[model samples]
Target: MAEVIKSLNLLESLKESIEKNNISDIKDAVEDMLISRINIALVGERGGEKAAFINSLRGLGVGNEGAALCPSSAAPDELAVFPNPKHPDFRLWDLPAIPSNTPFDPENYLERYKIIRYNSIIMTFTQNSSSNMVAVWREARSLQKDVYFALLASDKDTEKTLEAKKKASLEVLKAEGVSQPKVLLVCPTALEKLEFLMLLEVMLGDLPEIRAHALLLALPTFSSTLVAKKKEAFKALGWAAASLSAGVSAIPVPLVASMVDASIAVRILTKAQISLCLDDESVERLARQRGMDPTKLKGLRTCLLSVEISKSEVKRRLSVAEKDTSTATTKLVELAMPRHARSVSRSFTVMLQAINSAIDDMSADADKIIAVATGVSQ
Candidate 1:
């Protein structure tokens, strides 16, 4: 497809810029991949369920840093924003709940919360508030905003009760003039379930391709399936990191290229490790939330970078790469060549190998952690 070619060309252009040692262009390209803004509004009641859902989506716990503040009761006039701890560019806005007893004003709701700026508006409805939610949905629809409905289900909810709740929501929407209604039933306490994945798939389908990719990378690894998907997305990032590494290590000073390669690998792999939730913070939080000992859970991580991502460790990996003379040159090395041709070529190849191996190991560790957290067999 032409679009695919354009995408590939854009990456090639970035590689060219990096090869030219354009530091500003390299930073901008890397920033575009890591810090693209994505705003999603969760229009729902101020309660534990919504808070937990927000935290789960952002891959945080109720009390963790950057987690959504869980309110004790519902407030229909408050707006709280929570940034993803790992990816601050992706924000979750908790908008005011729809009033069940009063006449709801869609215009004021839309303007007061600045709903127009949101990439997507998710109206989370309880059993009794679908009517007001439908009112807001109609307005959001008119503005051509991506909108969705969700109903929180608890562990106590039986199949029949959940179906009844979903049916009741659809009936309310139908009465309010919506031709067809779909309410996603999500368990806020457990986001790795089938329903939540379905909801995520629908949302991703509607998002622009680039934004969808950003969202996919920003989201926490909730399941093995998600880990696998993230692994594929991170491959492109791996190449980008390698190009940047090669650009920075173009210096001709003896041993400078090797040292610079190790440093760049550490920086890139550290970010990758954190994004995969292989960091000590995420592991400890998971252990605390699941009532397990943190040390034991940390012991389960298999990736070298997962254990530690430092210059010394990365240098060791680079040494291993150098010793393994049979390393295959990747497209990244071919596409991006620096000033010191020979030194940069070898350094880039070693960095690429280390980065590729690190990404694979981190992804596997992420999947293992998710399996343990969800009690699912890998």
Candidate 2:
């Protein structure tokens, strides 16, 4: 049987760090649950496939119910935002396209939209790169926005046509004195088929670690690689939550130490659920796109999502894991493992194991949902 490991003093130290809520360490994990995001502006001419690219970037399709749409394409006021907007922090605004010859001046248009500046700019274009597109590039350049050029060619464009268009756009940028500009020719809906998405990550390389993490969390996960990345991120958070629980254990909680387990379990899972887009609303949105009932689609998961996992369930799982581990430890008395050294230590061990196990299960749960979203069997 696994005996209670005691180390109250150690738990005290860890709690101090967690209560600080500093996100400097990758291992500091829990703070990621409340990460804020920077703005990413998608600006270009109308036919640049900007909206489609945004959907693809977010791993959504035209048929995907949760996909963001252009104002002209859909009435913004009609959209469902009962609980909250998806990717609320990372705003991906679809700006009005500029006419080559228009009464609306570039500077005036920007002011009207209140787009003073952005963290990054996705400057999209096609074969005939007009001054309107160039105007956006110049404005973004003047504002010092991190701009990425994408030569968008949909499925309708011929391969030869795509190549010719790409070459022509590059020459335009060169003529404008933008030397060796990083340009991508991509089928907006098919991200992995080209290096555009990879280069996009490279573009975000300069952001701070925490900011970069927030962007990644907000990014669309269409592939296994992105899923794995999000999984590890959520896993990292478990330790911080475990640490938080250790702190709770140290506090005199009206004679109920189990309260710590319940509180931490629920809160941590809630954070992960929102971050991973596993909440009920997000699930419903995805299911609507797939033409499946939300509850039915969610039924495929082996583990509970944040909303589905109850406080009592958290306590129950923690109790079971501790009891099971303790029983197993009792049988391994030959090794004489030091599990009981301090009150907090024993409590911390139990909480850590429980939280880590929950995180792993949550990750798997998220994977199953992703599979459904990507048309793969769970």
Candidate 3:
């Protein structure tokens, strides 16, 4: 049987870190969780639809501002980087295409591309997988990297041809000593369909635990699975912030804790709004991409935090949150930190309650917006 791993209790660690008044560690933790670098490398031939795949993953259209330049050509020694407009820290890199005639050195290629820095690598192909790329894939596996094979299909491909391509790719990988290889057949223009979400889920499973939450929040698509994962991620974020606030205000002064919690609430809610694409800019961007009126998209918002998230607004909400000692919030606090359930202040519980409620509302707004954009009933 596999050994069970014990998860780290971050709240406990934060409490200890705060006992020494060492807010730096918890502060750094929060910042890292909020804006960590997540780099993905895409290795494909020029005009192999790498740019389209990257743009789709980043939720950008070809003509949109900050969209990746399609049909990319790059020098053999360098990697071309494309940053997500909403989250600059997340990037997609287009690695230079392998030379067909040259004797490829997988080790040298991996080193030249600086593959170690990337969180994941995706090898995309329109045709069969190149022996050279497969060699690099093998080398990447030896280094314990999360590498995937993706077959880029287009609107022209029929079901039979798509399955044929996937089978051919798998055969190539298996022949090259890959056991039970899984190939993702992806249509770049239609990421909401087919194996794209499956690919995302697989990658999430393979990624480091710390990165799973970030990846979930960073994804631009609005699906039921993603919505659920995003809610859990935001809940964890809220818990972290609440725990940190309680630590900072160790004396448990309701006024001081309330102020700290309010500030943290603003940060969390603002991030939630953008992550769910409910912010004005994101909504307008989504509308423009769909060739719809921005006002129509904006009108669907029913959440308080869906609009602009201001400090004054957040404070007002917290004032109201502090008034009602909701049983749901109390139970959540108890479940989150059982040992300190009795001692955790009212302000901390209230902050969690308010943050949780706001996230749910924003999630609902996101669902409504997606339904309207896709002309599907929610």
Candidate 4:
């Protein structure tokens, strides 16, 4: 309940910030969201696990060009950056090996890579935490940066095991003054942890609400819970999108009936498709992963964002809907957007129906995908 209230407050705060167009208040948020650049540095001991984890985040196979560099021995003491193959905006940077012989300098190390400048940090561990890692963790926290603790517990285990690992990590971190270290026992490739989703939630905290909203929309759709979060993230966007449609189409023409800005509508729907990873390519990849035909998967797009509907097609649907002698759609739109909708309200109705209908369709599509992936019918 508190979380829900917090979320609502943040959403409203962010919207207010954006609406007022206060440059300083929103410059970082706008830059982060618009550029879609989220820098997360993996700082830890040299090992293949962290490297493999980085690759898994990219969704690439073992031999792919941008594959996570998994070295049997210590990888060199240099930073390696990997762009998310699916999401160009998401980046993973692997910090250099921890020097065993020399005295570790957190300030110099952080400065050398400018890791201090990254949006987030993940200190990866398998066996146990190290002093150098603890040093970096304290340094990052001291600098007021978001730092997460990740444990590569790839092998499926009981919830008991997850909690035990998290508890131990928490105890160690508490001594270092980290009261609550968000720990994720995630298998990077499979993404099999509720805690992983929780970790993402943690990362969004203190960020501008709109920036958080953008990150939620742009995140790679991984879990059903994540899909739900994405939906909530987009709920407020519907009105803005509808307004854009209405605003763009308010030309001085004869009132022939309801009208919609097809171009704006198309752009909105296209962005939703891309943001939700429901485009042709993403759907195909998902299908292949499930050993199913991509053709069969087209019907799997129950989520409006995931559905493969184009702008022209959406426009056609809206046009048909406007003349369909259908008062039910018209009434629904009327009820949804009645405030200050006097002159161009009819056009608002057209857009409201178009977007609302897409939301319904794409939500179902998301359900289908989750059902297939989780083997639990929605």
Candidate 5:
């Protein structure tokens, strides 16, 4: 009896360990399997608009140069898999609908077509009054574990009509105890309604858990030419400051010039108002209309101001020019004034000066912020 108890205790301990540790390991292994081989299958009735719906999900069209999948019209009972551009691990299968008055054995159909291997099923429907659709949904729910319903309703139909159809379909799914099915509505012909289809692609492409976690975490920083320009300017400023601190006699003129040029380019690109409104023609026109002699204006131009100025400075310059309209030509000059040119020049000089004095201060503040963010630096 004592030997029996000892053996039983050992078995219990092993079971407990498995329940605590092995269960998580098993779940992780299963999830990895699903992630590696998960396939999304689209199934609907013949001539039911499933092909067009699949094309939209794949960001393709019938006659487009880059089609994700070329669907056949004659073969109503065919299946096609859309190519994934971003993720090649999973497959997207497009299955033709079952014919009407065909064998109604759901288990046999699923097994015959090997539909049970799919990770998710997208059932398409044109109308809510489809009896075959209800049967398919019922069968799918019984056999397939994860299923989503997508309604390819007509775009020309009134909003009331679409809403009624959607509600009816939702009710049917609810009646079968299918809770919170991921529903997507597509209007193949309507270009305006393509956003929903694109959203559906993103949702299906991302793992559910990853998508959920993304909502809580900060979004990935987008790096553009503008961002690169800013980083370059920051680095340049640091270098200039370091050079000045070491009592370097001559600054690298080319390096400084390049930094200034890049900074000006970035500033010009970002300022929509200045970039668009004040071109060379506009400046010339203002000078011509204001009757301010272009020669006199050119003579007045002293130094190419050190750097670009702020938006406030541009506005102020415009305001000053507007107020100083002693001559019609001057007034036109006010209207056509290169507000950005002066500000940009001034900012460049100010930034260069700041590089020397405030480098340590700026770097320290940036480091503190980075430290507080717990290794997250932008």
Candidate 6:
């Protein structure tokens, strides 16, 4: 268990180092850690429906009345967290289904929920005729990122109803410019019979790739494989912690305390980066200029910059360069284009040369700091 925690810390350090553009030594270190940890999360709407579907996928027996677990009656606005029954390292957060009658207000509610935390949203629909699922689809579309959908069609003979619902859902998604929605259809009997394992496997297979894509959009330089491996390591460590707790007598008290402190530190640092990444204007501007989808960019510029300037004095110096050159280039390009692409290109080349000269000048100042620090230590 201590080893597991250490692996997680190493993986995180690798991620931070890469973000800081200091990846010369960490590649092998991360690869070595990946062999021991693999973790995944299952997220969907609450009410026992999502749980029942997950249980079916795990081959758990459904109760006798053909009625699966009852969907929670709690207000659909709260976040729900549940542990994966089959995989100790995995967690499933069952989100409250978006209410059909209530209109969504994007401004006030966007950042208040856990919707942004998960790798993907697993939207479940009851049969093809259910309009409730369509409402959910609409809400997911408003957010403008790829979402995965699963259809839980009724076993009853509502074939036409099911068909109509599916058609309407697809049309709405298409009109909103969503090209693909990962769709899965399963029945109550299938849930009871534990036959949904195949579907679960398919979904699971695509998860790592999807998550990799998300991380890449946020931090282009950081490899997707690295992010996935880190996630896997975190899960493994969590599972190890749970196991250690189960046989409490076998574990020493001080070791447990140290492990808990490390886990808390990891979680805190991860959360701190969220705001920095999402709210940076420079990142959003660069993302737009590059023809990269903003949603795809996931506010990575802040993450990149944060690592480069982790020290307070270094950060203050970088902020000056960031403010001056970053925004002006876009305006200059806009003003220069079509008068002559070649002329504009030449101007940009000159600008980059000047920037490089300025950076070299700044490096001399950094040398002075290093000299002073070295002398003080001596």
TM-score top scorer: 3
Q: Rank the candidates by TM-score, best first.
A: 3, 1, 4, 2, 5, 6
Per-candidate Cα RMSD to the true structure, in Å, reads 4.0, 7.5, 3.5, 5.3, 22.5, 22.5
TM-scores, all models, native as reference: 0.82, 0.69, 0.90, 0.76, 0.40, 0.37
Question: Per-model C-alpha lDDT, please?
Answer: 0.74, 0.60, 0.75, 0.61, 0.41, 0.38
Better of 1 and 4 by TM-score: 1
Model 6 lDDT-worst window of ten: 215-224
Evaluate candidate 1 by giving its C-alpha RMSD to the native, one decimal: 4.0
Itemize residue pairs with steric clashes in candidate 3: none
- List model 6 lDDT by residue over 272-353, tens digit each: 2321222233234324433455554442232332223233333343234334555443443332233323322332323322
Q: In model 4, how large is the Cα lDDT of residue 229? A: 71
- What lDDT, from 0 to 1, does candidate 1 have? 0.74
Clash pairs, candidate 1, are none
- For model 3, the superposed segments whose C-alpha errors exceed 4 Å read 1-24, 252-255, 338-341
Deviating ranges (above 4 Å) for candidate 4: 1-35, 46-48, 61-65, 72-75, 97-102, 156-165, 249-260, 290-296, 302-307, 320-341
Q: Compose the digit string of candidate 1's lDDT tens values, residues 1-378.
A: 122223333476655676567756765666566557899999877767788888888877776766666663334576778788788788888898876666768888899999999988888755544677777888898999999888887667788898898888888888988887778888886787638788888888898756776788788777888887667666666565656666666655677666656665676777678777788988888788788888877888977788778787778777887777343454445545634444556656676677667788888888888888778997
Error of 1 at 265 (Å): 2.6
lDDT per residue for candidate 2 within 190-266, as digits (tens), equals: 66556676765676575555566567677655556666666665544454455555445556657455775677567
Question: What is the TM-score (0 to 1) of candidate 4?
Answer: 0.76
- Per-residue lDDT of 208-297 in model 3, one digit per residue for the tens? 856766767776855665766677777767766766665566664557766777777888888788788888877887788778999999
Q: lDDT for model 2, on a 0 to 1 scale?
A: 0.60
Off by over 4 Å in 1: 1-10, 15-23, 62-75, 100-103, 174-180, 208-210, 246-260, 322-348
Better of 3 and 4 by TM-score: 3
